[model samples]
Target: MKTIEIKGSFRKELGKKNSKLIRKEGYVPCVIYDKENNLHFQVHENSFQKLVYTPEAHLVKLLIDDQEINAILQDMQFHPVTDKIIHADFMKTYDHMPIVISIPVAITGDSVGVKAGGKLIVKRRHLKVKGLAEHLPENLTVDISELKINHSIKVGDLAYDNIELLDPKVTTVVSIASSRVALKTEGEEVAEEETTEEETAEDKDKEKKS
Candidate 1:
């Protein structure tokens, strides 16, 4: 797993007023919960963009007042209207401890279905997995070169050597779909629509006769 450096300050005061003041100064109030105790801290809001906005799961090296702890982002709070981050919470991780996190899914190779003019649809963009920090991966890749029309890759079909997938086995991850393959399908759809309209008109005529 890749690591990101986050430098912050340890906060001694705890209250809504103090938190509000910290936020007004463009800082986010954060907490790191460990097995022993909860540590309160504050980090600049601008410094959190790379960690929060990215799709990759990154191990955090939280540097607080010259002391560092290995942690992962557990939760965060945002303003309802503005969608700005207000607070963050982190969980301390150890070398031997296994933790669950969402890992991005990378689609590799052009699908055979796509070459047949069928649109490739990805049903799932990420999956939850559990593994130790050292064994975690940046992304899980799925080869779609052999996929044909109406074929799907499900969660049950995936296997990772280092991590355990927490998603349901039956869950679909990617597939190929779309009726708009060519002009033939379009003509068939138009004929179907015309038949439906004719049936509807006949029903209306029967109702009038009744």
Candidate 2:
């Protein structure tokens, strides 16, 4: 994956009051954690724009105080009213260990289905995958050059070197359906939506508890 450098300073205190103070100063309170310690820090809110706003995954070269760390963005909190990022959580990583993250999916080429008057619908924009940090790419690129009407590119159809897809094999990532010839696909999609929706709800619940 691509790497970007971010500079921050160690947070001297930790509390709701201190956090508010940090935000008032235009910095976002942040933390990096693992099984051991949680290191508190703050980085300029603007500094996170590229990392948080983009769809692609990126690794961070964190410069906090005088120490350097390599990490991946693990989670973030957004202001409910403004929809702005207020805080972030990162996880320190090593070269040899595996990390699970959601990577953006990039579809290339015009679908044959589209060319044949069928509408192509993207059901999933990203895929969750597990692999060593070095093995992960910036994004998972899928070529839809040969996708015909009513055809789909599911999680099971994808293959990558050194990467294990974490999503269910039957999950449709992208598909060319809903055309006159494929109207029946809509019924099948409803079932798939229910499955995906349940997974999303579970993830939200876990995030809230965390």
Q: What is candidate 1's lDDT per residue for 88-206, written digit by digit as tens? A: 99999898899888888989999887877778888999899999999988889999999987889999999988789999999999998855673456578799999999999999999
1-210 in candidate 2: lDDT tens per residue? 899899999998999999999898999999999778889999999999889888789999899989999999989999999887789999998898899888999999998778766788899998999999989999999999999887899999999999999999999999987576455555567889999999999999999999
- lDDT at position 99, candidate 2: 90
Query: What's model 1's TM-score?
Result: 0.82
What TM-score, to 2 decimals, does candidate 2 have? 0.83
Model 1: residues >4 Å from true position, as ranges? Answer: 182-210
TM-score of each: 0.82, 0.83
Worst 10 residues of 2 by lDDT: 178-187
Q: Which stretches in model 2 have alpha-carbon errors above 4 Å?
A: 180-210
Per-candidate alpha-carbon RMSD to the true structure: 9.8, 17.4
CA error at residue 42 for candidate 1, angstroms: 0.8
Clashing pairs in 1: none
